[model samples]
Target: MLTYCLNEYPSAHGFENGLRPQLTFICKAEGNEAAIPRVMHKHDERFELMFILAGTGIYNIDGRGYNVKRGDLLLFNAGVLHDENPHTSDDLLIFSCGVEQLKFEGLPLNYLTTRSQAAVMPSGHLYGEIRGIFEQIWQQVMSKKRYGAEIAHHLLSVLLLLCRNIWLENNPEYSSADSLLGQKIKTYIDNHYKDEIALKSITAALNMNQFYLAHVFKAWSGYSPKQYQTRRRIGEAQSLLLSTDLGVTEVANAVGYDNVNNFHRIFHNLVGIPPARYKKFWLTGHIKS
Candidate 1:
């Protein structure tokens, strides 16, 4: 029998601390020329971050392909399906971790993933700075120092804040869109999907006809307004189910569903399994492609 451990970097000292970032260790991975994408895997609501110290690869994440290389950081939020296939010549080495919850400046972390933060970041001084933070985290974990977890958690938070700000500066919304109308509709949905939102209200606010709005949104998203909203709700529910100890009813209500049964039905239809089973798969490490 082979036993694995998330204690690879934990210090050799007995430390006791309660308050810290909700970070979970999945594994620290290194890839080489033989690395090939096998299957897309996900954890219901766990966010995975990879600090690419060395690599040249193409990452297929959530239906998009991103060309990545050394000094790049990749973030996979919640339940996104992702695959990483590196170039035959370039070796890939990374530090990966799972986070159940993270925050910066009172803003939510989900916005980073939704805005396509999975793409490879450009390399430069900031890259080195961020990489240094990753190294510090590794050092603290390996140092066997006092308050090792606390130091690592604080470093990780700073790294996240830097990454989020850089991404925001680099990728400006509403600047580049297939269609302005589509962009507007998407923005509205992304911002208010968790609320008691309606297409009628959106159309009225944008001063656009409901039919035209629906048509353009569908053309861009391949999902109707209601369908897209349902998808968003389910996605949030999955995140909550995995990250928190919330019951099915609580999860449903948190995602804005008044009827728990309806939420379960819709979740099963989209996920091809019941909500409870889906949560169980992640909890038991039985996730699939």
Candidate 2:
């Protein structure tokens, strides 16, 4: 299986100018597959949107499994855990483009990360248009013509605008307190997980009382606000420990734990192992029965 580590375009290189929303097209041969070396990797500044033009595959995103086939589009937020592997013998053709320069007017970045699976499957001409754009972008990238990146970025921005419009049209109806509010709260926690974020702060941000936000968030996401926050922080910590060379203390800080002892205690309670051991296991990529 092919392994890829997506990182920021190095700053020192002149490639930074070309890095803005450049399309990367992959056409794998039969018998070729790919895997993410670990659940996560170094945090990059850009997001990725991928569409499968042909063939079938299995996508693994933060332990969730998805069946990918032709016409399937997938979005990944910066720092989210994700990987894809081909499942069929047919050659796999995929179009991937950066979202750094694209402005998705009505949709929040958190929406793409939290609701990516559902958003990709939404019915309507939106999906069709996105698929068509991907096809054209793939052709442009593969042709290696002059100004290909410029053309691809423009097409990708148009597709994103269409998607944002569809999302705005459906937002009110599809966004229940549970899904919408829960997603917003989750995003907040992800950004503030390392700090002592009070429930009051969370409720205030949502313009709701603590009681209502807590109850609704739990009902929708299957975890209380604090519980979900801790879980997410720990999950991110685990990913960093396993994937990056950052030290344990740095990983602890990365996830918002200032006290090393507290970090160890929580890591053990949630992961059932110490950070180092868990990292070792993650590196092995073993599927424990």
Candidate 3:
């Protein structure tokens, strides 16, 4: 009898440590003759690293298609849209490991954000080492041995480190400061939207030139620092309006707009309505005529 383990597989919620990074591995055992359909899926805030140990398939990621074969390693970032379709009748043995809570670690955030899937080619000595590690992980899963989760996590970490080395070696011009700095800035703005945050304060904290930082940050992040900050603040205000009993003025102030009139104007300019009416529309899901 061919057994399949999908939803019944164990969850990795208990693997979180208080300080270090956490890795999760989920395995599936599907029959070789199964016809897997194509579907679109996205992860909310976690990155996925997938390896195809056996079988032939085609994967569509970020609107680009890749012809995948055995011994192919793929990396995908958070919020990316991807799908998989098996082209052959052979049951696909796949390993999908998710890495969460990633720190800067001297790598650019753009490395994670860019939605390009490159196959890790094994050419030199590093190729064999990488392939061996993946094979060991695959074997552990197939054997259903004790402590497989722990073993898989350790292997996954080594895989990530190897990939990082390859990326740095290939792209010499990439900068952790230029790529990761903006993400740090955005994260800070998201958390502190309710407080008083200024360009000067941010530049000082980040130790970057004010004008140059703003230009490069906007160029890379697709939003000016101030614009991104305002958007986040308004988004928070909108959420509060719909979910809480807070008044318009309270919501505006809570999102860092001290002047109610200024908040009304900005809210109207962006949302096409004043704060009060916007809140009502959101609550009722009604469009004003």
Sliding window of 10 residues with minimal summed lDDT for model 1: 11-20
TM-score of each: 0.50, 0.46, 0.43
Model 1: per-residue Cα lDDT over 31-119, one tens digit each: 44235232234465667777767767666454344677777777776656455556644455677777766543333443243543334
Which segments of candidate 1 are over 4 A away from where they belong? 1-20, 31-38, 88-90, 104-111, 115-118, 174-289
lDDT of 2 by residue, 1-289 (tens): 9866556443222212333343333332333333212222223555666666566765544323467777666666655645445554546566666566432334343234344334343425555677777678768777889988678777865665555555445544445546666667777876776679899998787788898888777665556768666776776787777569999999998888889889899877765567887776656644233
The lDDT for every candidate, in the order shown, is 0.66, 0.60, 0.61
- TM-score, candidate number 3: 0.43
Cα RMSD, model 1 = 11.9
How displaced is residue 41 in candidate 2, in Å?
11
User: After superposition, which runs of candidate 2 have C-alpha atoms over 4 Å from their true positions?
Assistant: 1-96, 104-129, 168-170, 173-192, 195-215, 222-227, 238-245, 253-289
| Top TM-score prediction, candidate number | 1
Tens digits of per-residue lDDT, candidate 3, 20-124, equal 334655444344433233233446566777666666766645433467776666666666545555554556676666677643343333134333324333224
| Strongest candidate by lDDT | 1
Name every residue pair that clashes in candidate 2: 194-256
In candidate 2 the C-alpha lDDT for residue 98 amounts to: 59
